[model samples]
Target: MGIKSFQGKRTTTNTKESEPILVSDYMTRNLITFKEEQPIEEVIETLIKYKISGGPVVNEKNELIGIISEGDCMKQISESRYHNLPVDKNNTVKKAMITSVETIDGNMNIFDAANKFLESKRRRFPIVENGKLVGQISQKDVLKAAMKLKSNTWK
Candidate 1:
C-alpha cells in the first residue's frame, strides 16, 4: 500500500475581479437647490426647514453657479452688524455664495470620493455630469456604502 491517500480532491478557488462601486450608485439625486438671486432670509428659512447645512446655487438655466452655507449667512450677518444694517431681503445669495466651487464626477469610485472628503475636509461634494448638477455624494453616503459592503472585501 502507498501510504493510503486519505485526503479528498482539492478545488481551485475562483478569484474574479468585481466591478468597482461608483459614486452615482450612492449619490443623492433629488437635492434642495438655491438661486443666486434668492433672498438670504429665504435661504436661511429653507436651510432651517430642510435641516440642511448648505445647498448649491443655480442660475436661470439651472446651471450650478455657486454654493451657500450657514457660514456664508453668518458672514453676511456679521457684515450687516458691523455696518449697522439689518439683514434684509436686499442681501442675496450671490453676495454670500462661494463662486469657486469644486465638483466631482458621478462615475468616480466611492473609495476615491471618500479620500477626497478626507483631503478636502468637506462634508459633501456635488456630482456634475455634462456641465449640469446631477447629484451629490456625502460622507454619510460613503459610510452607508461601507456598511453595505462590510461582508465583502473592501478592495
Candidate 2:
C-alpha cells in the first residue's frame, strides 16, 4: 500500500520591485526658516507661534548658514542676565545660532537616516542639495514612514 501525502503544492511568482524609500519623500519642504540678522526676540516669538523647537538659518541667497534653537535662545537669556543686558534687538540669530550645522543628503535611505538620528541624538536633520537648504526630516517623520510601510517587508 502507498503512503498518503497531504502536502500542498507551492507556487512561485515574482513580485514587483518597490521603489527605494528616500529621505526626500518624507521630509517637510515648507519650512519656517530664519535669517542671521533676525532678532532673538523675534525668533523666540516665531518659535512659540509655530510651536517649533528650532529652525535653520539661511543667507540672502537661501544658502544654509546655521541653525537656531530654543537652547540657543535660553543661552542668550542666561548670558544677558549675567551681563545685565536686556534681551533686546541687539541679540540676533547669528549671535545665538550654531554655525557648525550637520546636514544630510536628500537621497539617503530612510533607514540610514533613522540610524543617523539615533547616532547623533538629533530630533531633526536638514536636507541639503546644490549647497542649498531643501527640506528637513525629523524622528516623527521617520516614524510616519515606518507606519506607512508597515505592510511591506523591511529590507
Candidate 3:
C-alpha cells in the first residue's frame, strides 16, 4: 500500500520477486530483544535459551540502538583466547554491539525489507516504529514469502 527504502534499497514489489510484502504479514512480532546496558552473559544465555542467532539492542526508552549476534560473542570468545572464564564479565552490549544497526518500519513491505537484508549483511533487522522496536524480520521471512510466491499464494 506504501513504499519504503533503506540503504537506497526500494521496498516495493509488483512482479514475482518485486512485490512488497507488509511487515505485519511476515515479521516476527513475538521477537526477543535486549538493552544496551545488559551484560554479555545475558546475551549468551538469551541466545542459547531461545536458539536465536541474534536480537536487537535497545535503550531504556525502547529505542533501537544496535544489535548483538553470535558473531559478536564469537569475537569475544576469540579475544579471550578460549579462556574458561567469562570473557565479558563487565562488558555490555554497548561495548560489543554493532553500532550501525539496520531497521524497518511495521508498514514496510516485505519485498523492500528482503532487499535491504540481501543487499546489506544483516540476516535480521529490528522493526522500528517511530524509532521504537516493535518487531523483527529475518531471512526466514523472505523465504516464507518466496514459498508462497512459488505457489502463487500471495494475495
Candidate 4:
C-alpha cells in the first residue's frame, strides 16, 4: 500500500500540556523544622504537639542538614543501667538526626518524589526552594498525586 498517514505522523514530545506536578502545588503549606542544635526532646514535643511524623533539621543559616522522625526516637532505648542513662540533654538534634539527608525540590514531579521517598528511609520530604525550607510532603501527598495523574491522563 501507499505510505499511510500514520507512517509519517510525528509523535508530540511536548509536555506543556502534561505539566509535572510540583511540591508547591501539593506540599503541605505548614512547615515544621527544627534547629540542628535543638534537643531531641523538643523534637518529640513538637511531633506530639502538632501530631506530625517528623521535621527537617536546619543549621543557623537555615540550610537543611538532616531529618528526625518519630521512628528514630522510638528506636532509642538503653540496654545498660547507665545506657538507660539518657543521652546528654544538651545534645542537639543534629546529634540524633540522620545527618545524611535526602531532599526534594518543589518544582519536581510527584512521580520522582514518591520514588525517592519509597527508596529511602525517609517518607517525609522537605520541600525546599533556593535552599530555604518552604513546606513538606509525605506519602499521602504522593498517593494523591498518583490519583490526580490517573484522573488527568484519562481526561
User: How many steric clashes does model 1 contain?
Assistant: 0
Rank list by lDDT: 2, 1, 3, 4
- Global fold similarity of model 4 (TM-score): 0.72
Estimate every model's Cα lDDT from 0 to 1.
0.89, 0.92, 0.81, 0.77
Per-residue lDDT for 20-107 in model 2, tens only? 7999999999999999999999999999999999999999988999999999999999988999988866989998999998999989
Higher-lDDT candidate of 1 and 3: 1
Q: Please give, for residues 4-46, the per-residue lDDT of candidate 1 as tens digits.
A: 5577676898988877889999999999999988999999999
Model 3 lDDT at residue 3: 56
Residue 7 alpha-carbon offset, candidate 4, angstroms: 26
The model with the greater TM-score, 1 or 4, is: 1
Q: Report each candidate's C-alpha RMSD, comma-separated, in the order given.
A: 2.4, 2.4, 12.5, 5.6
Between candidates 1 and 2, the one scoring higher on TM-score is 2
Which candidate ranks first by lDDT, i.e. highest?
2
Cα displacement (Å) at residue 95, model 4: 1.4
Per-prediction TM-score: 0.87, 0.88, 0.76, 0.72
Task: Give the Cα error of residue 140 in candidate 4, in Å.
Answer: 1.0
Q: Return the top candidate by TM-score.
A: 2
Per-residue CA lDDT of candidate 4, range 1-155, in tens? 77668657689876766677876688997677888778777788899999988888877777788888887655442322256676557756766688776668888878888778878856788876788777788999888888888897855
lDDT of 4 at 99: 79
